[model samples]
Target: MAILSPRRRRSTALTVAAVAGATAAGVCLAVGSASAGTISGPLYRDPSSAVVRWVAANPGDSRAAVIRDKIASQPQARWFANFNISTAQSEAAAYVGAANAAQQIPVLSVYQITNRDCGGASAGGAPDLNQYQTWVSNFSRGLGNQTVIIILETDSLALLTCLNSNEINARNQAISTATRTIKSANPNAKVYLDAGHSTWNSANETANRLRAAGVQYADGFFSNVSNYNSTSSEANFGRAVISALNGMGLSGKRQVIDTSRNGGASGDWCGDDNTDRRIGMYPTTNTGDSNIDAYLWVKPPGEADGCRYTAGSFQPDLAYSLANGVPNPPTTAPPTTAPPTTAPPTTAPPTTAPPTTAPPTTAPPTTAPPTTPPPTGNGCSASVAVNQWNGGFTASVTVTAGSAAINGWTVTITLPSGAAVTGVWNAQASGTSGTVRYTNVGYNGRVGAGQSTNFGFQGTGTGPSTASCAAS
Candidate 1:
């Protein structure tokens, strides 16, 4: 947390689960996204995240619904900010193990560098550089031999203005050692050093510091973690850094941006609560940019910046404001007829891309994008298409008119006991709890013969469910 008196920063791995390649865009998980969105790969969703836990414990909380849909349902990086070596090792193991079980890639951050945050509000780390290396080594052992992304310290390079040359050299040495420790233990682990944000330092300066800090041995560097800079701006900044790195003979390096809270205007405020912030794009590797590796939610929304609340603690109001009116691209409404759907309308990148066409007539053997049996009931047929990552899932229900036309449709979905709808769109829900009932909204209710319409929802506590539907 730099005291530039403006928005300043920001931590937190899993194995390469087959599911790690899938994104988690909730309502934006419309049809035809399989090849859609600038996003590439998917990241793991930690079920035990602050927002998920809060939503589950306070299922009836006033803000649970919005928070769950907007915040909890997406994949978030897990931080190992504590200095305790033993606890951190086991914690890392458990998280990566769970992600491997779910077949998704996990993102992690290691923030235990000595004298972190310039002794600002979020200051504190390992007692010294040697102990920090030991901590990172133990932590890396837990990464398994699967694909995982590790975001190193947030301000290690960007905030070097306060450190003397000797101190900076020592910190850079520690970073180099940590990178070697992580890569040696598990080559599958992708380690990203910190480059801060676009405004903090010039590209050349950031590149020089990154070189000193050992970016060559890591995956690349990350920008805007725990900051409020726009994604586009961060991407451009990343390009500058990459160009600079290339000039330094560091080719083939790519970067990931933290889109956790940069949906609104960029700012320089740090360590204080700001209500105008909004969650940015969902995490994805399909950034559509060659230089940019992915767009990630490195900083989980709602966690305080150490001013309004303790840093890393959940702040419900802040979470709500960040999630409120999220900027996800609009999804297509149900069609008038039920023929196989074309790609739904897409504005830009998707958090979790969904299949545009109808679910395969026959189920595929693969497990990542969990699809349901071909379904038809009463006067209408329904299909449940679900794409889940780690703890949360997004599903689309395509309802088709039968042999005859209908004026309206009602669909019933049986959620598992602990499952609930965190958010929904393209239809109105009867209740978020228990067996939820869904009905048509003001438009798209009418269906010509063989016509079709659709709706989608985001959920927690469980994955996809069987749905029964009918037409009026």
Candidate 2:
């Protein structure tokens, strides 16, 4: 049987929360007002994510362009799954602090339940339940009252067959207490427990385990963290789980799905091979459905799953393969290279240290939203490149100096009517809604001859497909 190796090297996240909430029967409930949470807003992007770090260090690497635009620029979850109790609070604070500064919701996964994954490749959690609970309490302290979303213990409720009756009871109780602990510390916290994926565990069984783990106190449940099951299958399975919970008298619970790796057909969960899968939807809270709070990137892309590579370490080739397969229409895995030899992980830390400073501005992805032809003027040229889904889009504008070095530059863009710019990074902008003018920030003001600098923004409605550059 395949077991999870849902290890991650570091943490950073982006999430979409909808205004609509769901009941046990998948009926929509009003959260605040009918209008809130309907549009996907900005989620924090960790400039220091594994993929971001790799792209920065290896800008010259053959795979840098694809990875930088596709994986690094977007928001992904930061796993607080490692056993670093002494530093847990501080680490969580630093990561959450950065997201708060950006005014974006940060998605996190707490995966340190005792004997998690049944000693499979992703094993070795807290030594005992007491210490684990203590760790949970300390971690909660770092949340600091921000709107945070947490995937509580990926395999705690789903992967329980390895535990005998008594052990299962203890594990479930541990989860129950931990959920309470997290929500208590920050009222704004939304805790979602794991329900495995659609392929594993029947809805009744998953629902029973969730109740034992205190689902009533949590915001809801999450599915397909590091797996590749299609989004529709998971959504259908979530409804079934919700229905089962309602039958058991637990109602009004909503669920989130991890779309990070579900862009393609579901793959084996217990292996080191991560190529057959592709990147799913970018992180967003604007899921159209009410019962579905958001579609999150719980498992950051490019990290290995412990079969052909070190569990949790970012592999550029795998990153290339996954990103290259984007908006992948669901299909059977193509005949290709056989998976590399499987090996047990030597060391796996669930989260990496947080970025203390502002993340560097990101570049445009080479694929996806096709770029408009660069129209040149005033000794420079610029391109408006985009990535879009449903009601939102993100665009990166790259400005390149002419043959002569330019001391300063400004770019004016006319957005499609009704487009609203929510956030801008790597540059200063004058307009928020219509015609917007962008100028180089202090550090990025100067560009070498023919060199380029870029800035990006998140917005609602149509994104501009063309741009013109003006530089002196």
Candidate 3:
């Protein structure tokens, strides 16, 4: 018999909450609304950050164009240019101006200066330190305080395992110099250093890098950028790193995280494409952590980074699958309790010896009929529903069980055909099985039976054709 993986058998329950209260309270409740609990800090709003790339990649694809228009139509959604300085300067200038003209903030990812594109698969930067600094200086010149959130060089510090000590040091220096240059140019600009996700770097190690990179000079460190992990885990991990930084003498600092892609955490180190996850609704509000400034959408949904576990390179079907939780195979039942046994009834011998011959021929006494087995009770069941409204999607689900309470579970959805998931919440998605599978990352292992929790996702898609639910 095929048994579902333990992680796959647990059921998922979803719940959705509305935005209410003051700005601060709204922020707190919005972030806390998910199953992993609330995250701290203000929510970053950026919609155009990924649309440009989608348009550029699929110049002729009508679906991409439609999604792009949908994204652009939203006043809250704005674009940011992420490219090597040499390639992005002109485009960045145009976008920056457009964003300012529209009275919106443009979130930019400054690449090219560091040794980016060096490692491959979202790797490689400047070949040398001086060159990296030069590029950042030029990149900073283009920003004229138009309100931009810069996600400086992702994985540059954490990828040290793939580099030598000297190389790592050089990269750190470049990042520090770049941060200083950007701040000097635009004091009003919100610049956040990329501190890879929690699973990748421990607090001590991440703090050490932050210190080396001069995190004090900038706002703070960014975590879970361009990765698929829930905000809860990221928040916990982010808090630990912030605490470590404070212990290292940098206290009361603020930071931000990229909630763009992590609707779910990666099931493995590599090659787990579960696309049902999407860009969580924009402006996710504040986490309670004083150090965490905001959760921003940096990675556009549906765009693939070359790893193809799904179709269309990005796999809309997989994205839908992940968005709607897919059922995993079943598992062995828990041990059952045994009932007590009764004592045997006493038997008596026949009294009459003279009738012994007749007694031997006597008929046996009648016996009571056997008891019937009890009806099997319903096992835990959960259902997640998703709907497309305006330029994004909303998700909700219900959980039921006979013997357990739904404490924690993951609900993932895959994007339908012609739809691309740009963001999600309380879950994560990556390339998997020719589709994207969204799974609850931090809360996946915690949901108990019969308990229900709800989450929401905001992204550009054809909306949801069908939404399903499963445990695990």
lDDT of 2 by residue, 1-472 (tens): 1123221122222122211211112112111111112223456677667776677677678877777666776677887767878878887888899789977778888877887544534456798999999999999999989788888977567655446789888988888999999999998898998786665567888898889889999988987676555576677778899999999999988778887755653222222443455777666665555667777888787776544566677888888877884643212212222112233211111111001110111111223332343333437777766544345555656677777777788888899988887656556789788889888766456776766655666567777887777875
Question: Which one wins by TM-score: 1 or 3?
Answer: 1
TM-score per candidate, in order? 0.64, 0.62, 0.53
Question: Worst 10-residue stretch by lDDT in candidate 3?
Answer: 1-10
Error of 2 at 439 (Å): 63
Model 2: CA > 4 A from native = 1-40, 266-274, 325-472
TM-score of 1: 0.64
Candidate number achieving the greatest TM-score relative to the actual structure: 1
Once superposed on the true structure, which residue ranges of model 3 sit more than 4 Å away at CA?
1-88, 264-272, 276-278, 284-289, 309-472
Give the candidates in order of TM-score, highest first. 1, 2, 3
| Deviation of model 2 at 9, angstroms | 12
